[model samples]
Target: MQDEDRRRYHDLRPDWAESYIRLERAASLIRTYEVQFVPGLLQTPDYARAVLSVVHDDPGEVERRVGLRIRRQALLDAPGGPRLWAVVDEAALRRMIGGRELGRAQLDHLVALAERPNVKVQVAPFHFDGHAAAGGPFTILRFPDRDAPDVVVLEQLSGALYLDKPSDVEQYRRVMDRLCTQVEPLDRTAAILRAIRAEL
Candidate 1:
């Protein structure tokens, strides 16, 4: 069943491409509910580089991709841009992707981002019991207009799968609500990062 669902959305069809266009235009607030790793918008250059390095064989191309990612993060900081909220799993903060120093830096970066009025950061502690999100990482992007359909992006080994179907989006929204309830409050999440920094 999982494989069938994966196959269904693996390739971006023409209709999916159109939906992506609509999503980009409609999105006014981006809420990311992440389970396996930190959201891309919160990743530091060093952290992103380390992640991309493992996948890209050519150093030159890897640098280009990292640069692009850094540029993309600017959208979150742009004036009058969409608000960003991210809920990350504790394991993401604990993962030593680029060693202790880089991990600490990344956590510190997330703390800084959490300070922004338009950005909210929450962390799901390891102590939480298994829930709907046990399936994997997913992101929900909301718009200012309630009438607009929400977009859900699911990540897999192959690529990103975007869900815009009303029923599918609603399902993910419910899952997000459950996950958010399990996470520590924003202030607590910041404290957790600080404690991790101290340990490093």
Candidate 2:
């Protein structure tokens, strides 16, 4: 979320730091295209801790962030929660972020989540032809309110760029649609996850 948008939405939900949390909570649907790691909304506690450890030197800060992330997971199971549609690059699944055991557990968690009605997970295999999103990972947040526009979030190491422009939103939506066509369908995700988990 941009600083300006943060201020605009400040009255809606009064929470400080990372206003993206408010938008995430308000979104009715979230579409994510991830090439490097699991989406935050779907990550397990161990995996979240492992990822946070690399950036934060303070163990206490890492635990705090991990706890916040885990608490956010509850939204997925809440009644009438937003739908989560994720297209993950196959390499992300193969990478052992927290070592083999943790990787396997992560995959197991993914398999379980895919069973939810509102959650859709797809794997973009290495052999995927004509990759649409060469630029890298991004997430699109959409609200149920018809008047509110779609938002595209492009993240970097330091911060994230939020775009609500109609042109930008459509362009990213097209890329996401193309990526979905290139990746395995929802039904095949389970078998793919199991195979990768076996490798771990």
Top-scoring candidate (TM-score): 2
Q: Give the root-mean-square deviation of each candidate in angstroms.
A: 7.2, 4.9
Kindly give the stretch of ten consecutive residues in candidate 2 with the minimal lDDT sum: 8-17
Regions of candidate 2 where Cα sits further than 4 Å from its true position: 1-17
Q: Where in model 1 is the C-alpha error above 4 Å?
A: 1-26, 145-147
lDDT of candidate 1 over 97-124, digit per residue (tens): 8799998888889989889898889887
The Cα local distance difference test for each model comes to 0.75, 0.85
Q: TM-score of predicted model 2?
A: 0.90
- For model 1 the TM-score comes to 0.84
**lDDT value, candidate 2, whole model:** 0.85
